[model samples]
Structure formats: structure tokens, C-alpha cells
Target: MPAPTHLLIPYSFRRKGILLGALLGILLTACQPRHEQAAEAATPPVGHYEGSLNAAGQPEVRATLDIRHPSPGHYEAEFTAPGTLSFVADTIVFSNNQLRLIRPARPGQTLALTLEGDFWRGALTLDSTRATTILVKRGVPTPSTYRAEEVPQATGSAWLFTPADTGTPGAALALLPDAETAPTAAIWADALAREGLIVLLLPPTDSATAAAETPRLLAAVRLLRGTAGADTANVGVWATGARAAAVAQLLTTAEAPRVAFLMAHNMAVGPASNAVLRELRRRKLAVLGLYGGTTASQRATALRNALGGRRGGTVLTFRTAGPDLLRPDGGAFGPGLPGAVVEWLQGK
Candidate 1:
């Protein structure tokens, strides 16, 4: 078989053409902007950040930023400057390597940060004042302030949070939610304990009826009353979700303990019924209702209106916190929430 000479180009020429093509491709890639090929704004910088906030006339303030994407299509960010500034951003957005954290409660207040290498550089603007800031990713684990021990009940186990401090607790509160199972339960319990209050964290129940929960509630109250350092006379209940309704129902029954107060956290609706409201009013129990997140104001307003003219019925938004009452990282309580509860209970 004879090969056709016209179809066979010179080997040297073919090699040169291949080399030239690869060189052109390399040049094109190298000339393109680096950002155009990078990942989308580095996945929104989700984690903890700590650094400094600088004001023109004041000393630098240490600050921290916690950013989290708890679920799909939702974001949480909390910024704290110790004694200076603290807020949970009502909305968050990241685009083109820029981050914007905003809270609608404070008009003209916004945190604008730009991603730089391994840190965020920007300014926090409040009204007309803008403070320059820088934040670097850091490990800041949520602190635990109390020791927990499991108390076995006939139905389930509960957790008792005794403050590490030697000082006697001023009051006792039975957290009647899924405190034993919820992810942030320890943080809530410890936060209360940090304020010199003994927290009895009740376990989740399987029964749907308040009748079944009544005995458990009474037992928790009794345990708190018997705790060595707790002020038995000042025992109260802190509740959320359906358990809140159960607590309300229990309060109206003859078997109910004489609870001093009821601290309701982030409830979307008002009391379970008019009967519950009447029971609360008749008992003259101090009600400290804290609402947070997007619907906080509306819920607070509704609760306030529901208790119109009733003394000891205090319902308000909880310092612009998120619904869960925990920071984005689930490490600590939201800004001033535990402190607010302590302050109100102290006054009571």
C-alpha cells in the first residue's frame, strides 16, 4: 500500500501549529480577570468573625459578627460590640463580594462589609455616624455558665441547671418547652442560670393532652421549690409552642401550683383562648411575653391588645432578636434576652 504525499503534511509544521494553539489558549486564560473565574463570593462567609470597630473620636471597640445559614433560603446574622452595639439583622444579602446586614427597627442603621482575602472590611452606619470596622474569622464557642444534672422522672428525664456560682438564686423557672431536646436548650438554661436563677429544664412529652402534662408540670414546680438554693416562693414557668398552651390550661385547674410568673417566648399567636386569658388575669400572674423575628412587632401588639389594662401583663419585642432567642451560631442567647428576663423578674 502506498501513502498519498498530498495528504501528509510535514511533521514539524503540524507540531508547531499544535504548540501555537496551546500558547494562545494559555494567554487567553491568563489575561482574563481572576474574579470572573472564582466561586460565587466565597459562599457568603458563613461562620464567626471577631475584630475591631473604630470610631473617629473614640477608642476602638472589639466586635464580633456571627453569620449562619440555618436553612435553605434563610440567613441569620448577629453583630455585637460588647457594651456599645448589638443587633440581629432582620435581613441579609451577599452579592458581588459584598455583605449587607440590616435591621428595620433602627432606621438608617446598616452594616456594609466587603470581602477581602481572609477578612471583612467595611463600616457600620448609624444615622449620620459611620464607624470603620474589620472582622476576621475566629472560633468563638458559646459559653456554658451552669452545670447540668439529669433528674429522672416517672415519664422522662429533666435537666437541672444549678449556677456554678455559690450565691443563692433569686428565683426558679421551669422551662416547659422541649428543653431537653431542643438544640439551643442548654444555652437558654445557662443564660437563665447566669442571672442567678435556677432553671429546671423539662423533657419533651409524647402526650398531646394538657391533662397528661399537668402532673409533670406540678412535679417540676415541686422540684424547683425543694431545690436548696432556689427561692421557692418565686418559682415561675417559661414556655414556648404547644407546651405554652398546656401551661396555660394547667394554670386554670385546681391542681395548678401558684406560679409567680409566666415568660412566653416568641409565640406567633396570643393565649390559647379567652378562658386562658381570663385565668391569667384572675390569677394576677406576672406575664413577661417576648416576641422576636419578622412578626415580632405584630405579635407583641396583638398580645398587648389582648391583655389591655391588665397589670403585670408586659408584652414586647425582645431587643430585635431572632425567633429562636439564640445567636446565629447557636452558641449564646440573643442580645440582652436573658438579661431582660432577669431584670423583669428581679423587679417582680
Candidate 2:
């Protein structure tokens, strides 16, 4: 009466056999080479990269790349060569462990790069020749602790530079640079801060927003007094180019008493400027003028003539250092310029 041997196998034993087989398959897959497993979990490199461009018969250019991945298979890239050229890629592609950034334009160029360890190796092809480029992984630059802040009732922004210890009320300086000179303005702010003055850098604004200049400057002065703990009576206004003219006009208004000192650089003596100087003289404001000997000597002379009989007004001219005294990089000033400004500001 015994059943066939095959029929004697229990259903529970068959289920166990199937489960064991599946586990063995998974274990074998896990034991495969790590390289094979890594291929499935790969991620695109995303971060800041710094490098240089070397071309025949050209100055070496520093380059920085910023790469970002927003979603799967989507990327954004910005390439910058400071003081030379820069562009953002309209299209970015990453596939098969390689990255390609492209933007449609004339004199077409392409960047083909691959990540190798902690660095990226690439070639930038323009026209016919390819330039070898190497970019190392780097962290994004940390923003400066000294930073720009919007004035409560102003049109443009002001960068505030506070000393490490501003124990008591000190003099406040309002720095107004040319429209294209914020970087240089920051440098001047730092230099003045080192001399124990609270520096508020007001960047140039466009004509469309020009009407806000006076109120914005007044608000900045108040901010320096209330927030920065500056002596309102000792505040000064330093401006360049058209900004100087504007500051001159501002002083003619009822708020003239707010600024105790005035320094105007590269401003020409004209009807408008003359009127401003007259008002400043009437107010007994201490005024300092700096001009380039080669480029602004005539203007400087005219200004000196206008201020000849006025007390507390002085004009100095320097050769080779003109309006471009602030380097494009904003990291440096013309030779001896910083010392001169510091000396004048400190009444030395």
C-alpha cells in the first residue's frame, strides 16, 4: 500500500527548496566584483572646480567651474575665466561616467571631461586645437563675513565693514564708487576699516533709480549712527566721478550738517561742481581732492582755483594713478594710494 516515492515528497519541503535556491542566487550576485556593483549606484560629480588655461602666446587665465545636478540626468554648469571670459552652459550632459557642457555660439567650443579620483581631466576644443585642462575638486568659496545689506529706505545696497571691536562711537565713512567699481570699493572699505573707521560702501546705481540717491545716503548715514555706533557728527562722504558730483549736490541740500568731511576724486570743476564746492565751503566742511596728474591735472587745477580762498580744502595730484587706480580685480590699489587715503582720512 506504499505510495510512489515522488508522491511521498511533502509540499512544505518543496517550498523550502525553492526558498533556499533564491537565497543562493542572491548571495552569488552579492559576491560578484565590486566594480560591477558600483556601476549601478554611480552619481554625477557636483561641486566647484578650479583650474587654469594656458594658450600659446597668451597670458595664463584662471578658470573656475561650478556644476550642479538638480535631478536625475539633469545638470547645470557655469564656466568662468576671471578677467577674460565666462559663460553658462545652456545644455549639460552626463552619461557613461563623462560630462559634456555645450552652448550654441560662433567659434564653437566643447568641454569633454571625465572624473579621475579627486580630479577632473578634460580638453577644451576650439577651432582645431585642443587645450589640456585639469580641474581639482574644491569647496565653494565662503562668503565674506563683511557683507552688503539693504538700507531700510534706500535704493541700492551698502556693504558694511565693522571692526572686530568697535568699543566706542567712531567716525563713519560713506564710500560711493563709480557704477562699475564695487570690487574696488570693497578694497577701499577694508583699508579704511584697518584705520579704525566704520566703512559703509554704497555701490553705484542706474539712472532709473537715481532719484533715490539722496534718501538712500541719508538712511545709510543714520544706519551708521544707530546700528554701527558711529558718531553722527563725524560722518564723512567720499565719492568718485559722477558720484562725487552727486554727493556735492547732496551736500547743498538741508542735510549738509550730517557729513563733516568730504573727499572727491576725479571730479571736474564745472558749474555744477563749483556750486557744490561753494555750498560746502559755506558750511565749513573739510574737503580733500585727489586727481591724476596726467589725466585730471586741468580739472584739478580748476578745482584748486575754486577752493583757493576756502579754509579746510586741499587738493593733491598723483602721477600715473588716475581713475583706474582701483585695479580690475579689486584686490589692490595703485601704489601709495592706500597710504595717502589713510593719511588724509586720519588728518595726518
Write candidate 2's Cα lDDT for 1-348 as tens digits.
Answer: 111011101110000000011211211111111111112434557788899866566666777778654443333465655431344443455565677664322125567788887677887765564666788879863222221222211233345555534566667888877764543455566556655677876656664122445765665565567545477778888877777777777777875437788888787688756767887787788888877546667777777777755354888776565464644332235667677877777663
Question: What are the TM-scores, per candidate, against the unseen true structure?
Answer: 0.55, 0.54
Top candidate by lDDT:
1
CA-only RMSD, every prediction: 21.3, 21.1
* lDDT values for all models: 0.62, 0.57
Tell me how far the alpha carbon of residue 317 in candidate 2 is from the true structure, in angstroms, after superposition: 2.2
Cα lDDT of model 1 by residue, 56-75, tens digit: 88788899888764443333
Q: Top TM-score: which candidate number?
A: 1
Model 2 regions more than 4 Å off: 1-156, 208-212, 255-257, 309-312, 327-331
Clashes of each: 0, 0
Off by over 4 Å in 1: 1-145, 154-156, 165-169, 178-181, 268-272, 309-312, 329-332
User: Candidate 2: how large is its RMSD?
Assistant: 21.1
